[model samples]
Target: MTDTLTDRPRGRQVDPAEFAYADELAFLAAYDEGPRPPGWQLTPRAVVTFIAGSGGTAVELPTKARRKGLPSRLVIGQKFVGDRAVVERCVVTLAGERGLLLVGEPGTAKSMLSELLSAAVCGTSRLVVQGTAGTTEDQLRYGWNYALLLAHGPSPEALVPSPILAAMRNGAVARVEEITRCLPEVQDALVSILSDRSIAVPELSGTTDATVHAVPGFALIATANLRDRGVSEMSAALKRRFNFETVGPIPDLAAEIALVRRQATSALARSSSTFAVDDAVLEVLVTAFRDLRAGRSVEGWDVDRPSTVMSTAEAVAVAVSLGLAATYFPGDRDVLSLVPGHLLGVVRKDDPADGAKLLGYWDGAVRRRAEDGARLWRQLWELRDALTD
Candidate 1:
């Protein structure tokens, strides 16, 4: 991996290149040949390869490091399951001087993609504003210390620039997570920032006429949840300024399972736990997730739907739990016993109807699959009584 971002800050300011899987991004940059926007590190095609794995292409490393290689943890299996064209559109939009709005249901990886994009482009993904009801116009534009305004008066030091402002000055991508969580007026703060391409500070005397124009590669990537539609829809004025992209759930079951396994395995390894979960049990867990998430079974068995968002993130956690149990307990104790308990944890969020849905899944898919003689699923079927109890 390239050491370009080693000197950057950690925590609140992580070198995007070093965030999680930096080697993949470094590899992408090494062979990248596509056009790069001013101040950007890699081409759009390289950015795409960073997020979507190389499919085992040999990524050469820089020779200077005494270690002569990348950190093992940096090797990650690609997770998103969709057409490459979708990711390409996102990359292209950012390469241009346009705002990219990623709208999706919870757990669709919209926010993750935004982070990866910023890291790949600017070598840092730290500039971010987490939108909430308390998010104000000041949070997006600029705010001042009341003490400073009262004493020394509104000067640049007294004026605390928001993440968006910092990104503008540095020509980096700024992320606004959960944009819909913010109130409508708060969300509208982006309108002028996008269209006018600058933020006017009227608080200062001489600088009242001055506006903060974004640097060449500066861009905004905001994520909103589709389930949050009624909470705060984007105003027409704001929508016009952004290139909107909708990220959907993983399209295929096998792809989803692979993602779950990779994520879960990493987590298990981190805790120093050795998992004994077999392929069959993994299939059962993923099968259940697919059925619940899609509101039906693989073989067309009907299942009741839960109100809780059945995101891939939740599936990964459930798989991790199963692996943990297999690691700690092992053998004849049975991993299926934990399945209902985990399913209940996922389904029993805020609604009682979700319980009914779990029961429906047990009856429709669990019973049928067990009778069809899938041994692992059959074990889970016998343990279905655990959900009710």
Candidate 2:
């Protein structure tokens, strides 16, 4: 039997999403009373509750069949902070065994949502193909176990199944991250697989090792960056197989700030340190990100937006960096002062001209806010020299 995630060593650096929330998952699975699709671990409704959270409401487990030592009440935690309608559409698509394509700017949590959905639906999220220019067709299909092929000659044991094939055979969800990064030809490999819901093995054809058909509940969740959408745009034939959903940045300032704080604090705690990032500092950071990302400030100032994507995920990262600096290098610098440098780092990616754009934002938005008597903006405006120097 496969070892449960809870069986892994405690000191491991990373925990799979399945393992990290094993208890919660187990509880939810026990309490999932709705009808489920074939080969699905949880019903469609249960899957939604798991990803979007259950609002801390207690779900009652079956009295007769509750596992020994299990809690009777399970409160599912909210993981993704986005539109409920969008998540519902994703769940419905997956239920129909259709491909789900999540396209958005960088750091919109598309990959995270995909992982969470896969985990909730199948109890495993590791069946993934990370798409890139270097990704080959073999990654989407299957490869030959050279040693076994040499000895047995195209036998079943000689075939090494890719994650996609494995998921298909087992009726599980398969995730392809950054699909647009793959060459167009390589991306096309998925077209046949999705349309036919099967993979043909020519090497083992005419024998028992021919085509592998997908069982019910098998689906594909792919993510593509909007910036790279045109790099190697997917063909029309492939696009027809998918239900496209656009994941955007968090729309609420308070919610975004809360997300950044929670994530940054958790990250800091992992290092055996406490989060000391002030609320005021985090507010400034998030405000800046939102303003720059939208190409305008909250006060209605026109700011030159950078070419680089400024996402909530990036704001979390900057907050985490500030927390780490305060924990390790306390008093060396003020957390507020570090904001400009971090924003510069985030905006100056890909294009050198973006740095100047960032500076322009500082001159317009930051200066105007300072003039409005906002102390945080005043401090940020004083640090405008940081961007130039």
TM-score of 1: 0.88
Candidate 2 stretches with Cα past 4 Å from truth are 1-10, 62-65
Best by TM-score: 2
Model 1 C-alpha lDDT per residue in residues 132-181, reported as the tens digit of each score: 87889889988888898889976877888999999988899999999888
Worst 10 residues of 2 by lDDT: 1-10
TM-scores, each model vs. reference: 0.88, 0.94
Candidate 2: C-alpha RMSD to true structure equals 3.3
On the 0 to 100 scale, the lDDT of residue 121 in model 2 is: 91
Backbone collision count in every prediction? 0, 0
Name the lDDT value of residue 76 in candidate 1: 34
Which pairs of residues clash in candidate 2, taking residues 3 or more apart in a chain or in different chains? none
Pairs of colliding residues, candidate 1:
none
